[model samples]
Structure formats: structure tokens, C-alpha cells
Target: MINWKVRFKNRSWVMAFVAQLMIVAQMLLQGLNALGVTDFQLTDAVQQSILTFVNAVFILLSLMGIVQDPTTKGMSDSERAKTYKEPN
Candidate 1:
């Protein structure tokens, strides 16, 4: 019943999409770092510290986006079942 048109009128779907992708990207980066596929100029502590900070920020942003945007969260399992009910 909510009017999502106004809800997402000026929203940044792309940013949310990218933020969601960042987790996967971070995983890939970690894999590559472990495999020695990329060069890391910083010490392990410095690299871990920076990545930790970034991951925290990205998680916070993604949480905020999902909370604020209805579409991203989708409907609940019970709510979807309600849509199929037949009136007697």
C-alpha cells in the first residue's frame, strides 16, 4: 500500500547496488591478496586496519539503505502468502 514512487524518487539505487557488491569485492580482494595476485604496499596491520574501517562503513551504509528503502528488503514470507488468499 505504500507509494514507492515517491519513496525512491531521488534514491541512489546504484550506490546501494555498489555497496552490496563491495562485500563480494572485498572477499575477492582478500582472496587475491592471499594468492599474491596483487601487490600490497602497506604493512599487514595497516592494510587490515584500513579494510576493517572501510568494511564497517560499507556495512553501516548498506544497513541504512535496506532500512530506508522498502524495495531492497522485499516483502516478508507471510506477506507474500497473504497476497494469494482467496476471498470467501
Candidate 2:
């Protein structure tokens, strides 16, 4: 008795969750480097700034997924038949 729509929702949530997790990891690593725990081999300031910006973008995308309402992804007529057969 599993709904495919629910599964699709879970998939989106998992990807967003992983994206947010990576953001935290990247930010922490940058903070560590800022403290001089490790040297930034490639022009520290510039590269770190770029990496931070990319991570921020990823974080925003993830949050968008978390908050957005999902619309029916329009199933083909054949697939749509299955949905109609379900008890309303």
C-alpha cells in the first residue's frame, strides 16, 4: 500500500537534506582553513570565496526545494489511468 507520489516526495527531501549537509561541511572546512588549521594551496582568499559562494547557492536551492509545493508532474495517459483507478 505504498503511494508512488509519496516516494517521489521522499526522493526530493533526501537530495535536499544531503545538499544542506554538504553546505555545513564545506562551511566548517572553510572556517578551519580561516583559522590556519590547514593552508589553502590555491590562492586561499580568492578560491575560498568562490567555494563559499557556490555552497551558498546550493544551500538556497535546497531550501527552495524544502519549501516549494510540488505540482503533479503530469503523468502520461497510460500512467494517469492508474491514478484514476485509485479510490478517491
Candidate 3:
């Protein structure tokens, strides 16, 4: 089973996933709009706001992820082997 805490520990991954999800949602909304089920217009203002928000969020996430201390990340293969005394 996947560990939710471990999977979501990386800010960059979460941000990128959210950004991609937004893209997929936009596509689905557009499809709905085309079908006359909704009026999801991509006006210049709306486009600028949503895209700008997503881009800014991604940038922030990347910066945060890069700034995290290395110790908090899982050990490297060499470090793990040395610490665990695994056979070669």
C-alpha cells in the first residue's frame, strides 16, 4: 500500500500534480461548455488569472522543494548500504 504522507512529502510533486489536474479540469470544462451544459468561457482576464496562478504556485513549490534539507530526504543508496551494513 502506498503511504500518503510519504507520497505527499515533496512540495514540488504536489504542486506539479495540482497544476496538471487543473489542465485536465480545464479540458473537461471546455468539453462541457461545447456541449452547452455550461458557459465556461476562456476570456482574456480569466485565462491570465488562472494560468498566472498555476505558474506562480509551481514556481513556489519548486523553490520550497529545492530549499529543503537533504537529511529529511530518504538516504542515498551508498549511505543506506553503509548505515545498514548490507552485503555487497
TM-score of each: 0.50, 0.45, 0.46
**lDDT, candidate 1, 1-88, per-residue tens:** 5433433343464466566677788789878988999876578799899889978877787677642455335643234433433311
Model 2 CA deviation exceeding 4 Å by range: 1-9, 44-63, 67-88
Instruction: Write candidate 3's Cα lDDT for 1-88 as tens digits.
Output: 3234543565644656676677688778868988999975789898889878976775676566642334444533334433433233
* Native-to-model Cα distance after best TM-score fit, residue 24 in candidate 3, in Å: 1.1
Clashing pairs in 3: none
- Which stretches of model 3 miss by more than 4 angstroms? 44-88
lDDT against the true structure, each candidate: 0.61, 0.61, 0.60
- Per-residue accuracy of model 2 over 1-88 as CA lDDT, tens digit each: 3354543456565566567677688778778887999876568688789788977777677567652335444332234434643422
What 10-residue stretch in candidate 1 is worst by lDDT?
A: 79-88
What lDDT is reached at residue 31 by model 3? 85
Instruction: Give the candidate number with the greatest TM-score.
Output: 1
- Evaluate model 1: give its TM-score: 0.50
